[model samples]
Target: MSTQITTDRLVLRPVEASDAARIADLVNDPRVYRMVARIPANQTVAQTLAWIAGHTAGREENTKHPYAIVENGELVGVTSAHRDSTWLPFEIGYWLSPDRWGNGLMTEATEALVGWLKQRGERGFVSGYLDDNPASGRVLEKLAFMKADRIKVFCLGRGEMVGHVNMARID
Candidate 1:
């Protein structure tokens, strides 16, 4: 995978076709997706592959960035940011594999992505952590994202509840 940028101990690159299973397994783990509402309770590898393809392809085609975080040559997480078609500020989102928890991989990837986004002269704010996922909130806090507001039950899908928090980095 080509490098988007590398931290001292982690590599961030674009997601590849072969990475779908690894990402799928990790995402399918109950611990990771229990709080995420939009994803299915039992996501098949096929569904994951398709979802990754569509999301990553859309991002790449639009010049929006979505990076797969690699540690020791293994895909362990993801980080991304982009404006929706509505001209909103780029929404920054991320997830780290359960196996990689406590390794600082996600935090490292987030810092790299944020700094990269800023250096590219990107404008608008970056919203962070909208799914009642406090782990994400913690990372965003580390990156200096401030809470804007909260929207209860932003989406109801796949038999899950999705609350949202709006955040911004106007710097």
Candidate 2:
């Protein structure tokens, strides 16, 4: 089941319908969309609401855990842990508003989520970063995820294939 987690400066909670507007605003930014593989650019509120509904349903079905990243009670980004059909390990992914970059918030949020998973007896979580987004690689390194492999994957948002670095933390 999805649970709420709080860090020093952020709250990681399940996505809700009310979060549609803020989520749309953050993701509609080209900077944010460019880094995310599945999210399309220029998403409208209606589209975001539909996505949130699906996310909520996914959580209920035990298919995924998609969270809203709240800072000061405002949604600024999103993070999730879910199954990957192509890979057997649980996959963790996240994205933040461009304005919030360089602040270490993603690192902090990621660590908290990893800690939560560890406490629940979960290990060997998997994730990937685009070859161009070295910053994301650093975040995985901070979590002690070792590089497992590199592969080319199509980014739906970018509408092109990009190199990806697969990472895993077995401990």
Candidate 3:
């Protein structure tokens, strides 16, 4: 399958090493970090590069697909699908620049990602959002992801475990 995907207003392409600086800047923003689970607050460019390398390895292994979300030729966010084990459904995750919120870009980007995965034979997907982030829930709901469970997961940025709502899309 092609690594590049495009929607009405965005281009979703494989995350590149060159995007490290921009990615770091976006994810390190307090607004973005608070909603995302894995990124550290005040993340450095080197750390971002390491993360990009992992995505590179994931691509080679066919175990993860991370995309750089581009709109109007600028990198605006990141989205990805990955699984810890073969039997588990691939989990979808994303975070965007706070300035871009409420614009439906996330839904558009995620829907395109899910559709791309479906075309590649991915049948089940899992995603979750912190309980405090209802906008994320709305995005998943728009994609037909049903609430599956409520659990606490560590939010590295938040520096503590937070209430999480897991959602799944099964085809």
Candidate 4:
């Protein structure tokens, strides 16, 4: 079974199949979608379910770990870490409901996720945020992720390559 983690004010649970509709509703918001690299804008419930379907296999293979952010029993966001190659550091990413921004929730959730990974003996991690999204950069900074460099990345929601600020942390 997938692991569930709890924090003082949040619960980090394995993403469930039943969460597809809520996930779709969250990611479909342009405020959330435009900031996340992979999520398409206006995603459908079917698409979100298809994405959630991979979490189990990903967890088993250790290629990806995605968690649903829950506050007061309500699902609010998603955070994950993944690496394309074993030699590469896991790249952490997240998207929260716009209503939850500016509350330091992402920072808290991500810090817990990183701690969990470190407990599993994983150390190095990399993350990036759209250059335009300073709030996300702040979340990484608060977690001791230093600015590594800048690069251009393709954002599915924007339909174009955009400036991205890469950050890294070695626990």
Best by TM-score: 3
What TM-score, computed on C-alpha atoms, does each candidate reach? 0.84, 0.91, 0.97, 0.96
Query: Between which residue pairs do clashes occur in model 3?
Result: none
Local distance difference test values of all predictions, in order = 0.72, 0.85, 0.92, 0.90
Candidate 2 lDDT over 1-171, as tens digits, reads 789999999999988888888888888888888887778878899998887777676676555778888899888888887774423456889999988899999999888887887786667688989999999999999989999999998887788999999999888
Alpha carbon RMSD to native, model 2: 2.1
TM-score of 2: 0.91
User: Model 3, stretches more than 4 Å misplaced?
Assistant: none
Best by lDDT: 3
lDDT of 3 by residue, 2-82 (tens): 389999999999998999999998888888999888888999999998888877877876678899999999999988999
Residue-by-residue lDDT tens digits, candidate 4, 1-171 = 358888899999989899999999889899988998899988999888888887678787777889999999999999888887667788999999999988989999999999998888888999989999998999999999999999999999989999999999998
- Give the lowest summed-lDDT range of ten residues in model 1: 153-162
lDDT of 1 by residue, 1-171 (tens): 124788999888877778878877877777666645445556778987787677665564444577888888888877876565635567777778887787777888888987877776666656655465787788778888888887765332335345777777778
Task: Please rank every candidate by TM-score, starting with the best.
Answer: 3, 4, 2, 1
What would the C-alpha RMSD of candidate 1 be, to one decimal place? 2.7
Q: Candidate 4 regions off by >4 Å?
A: none
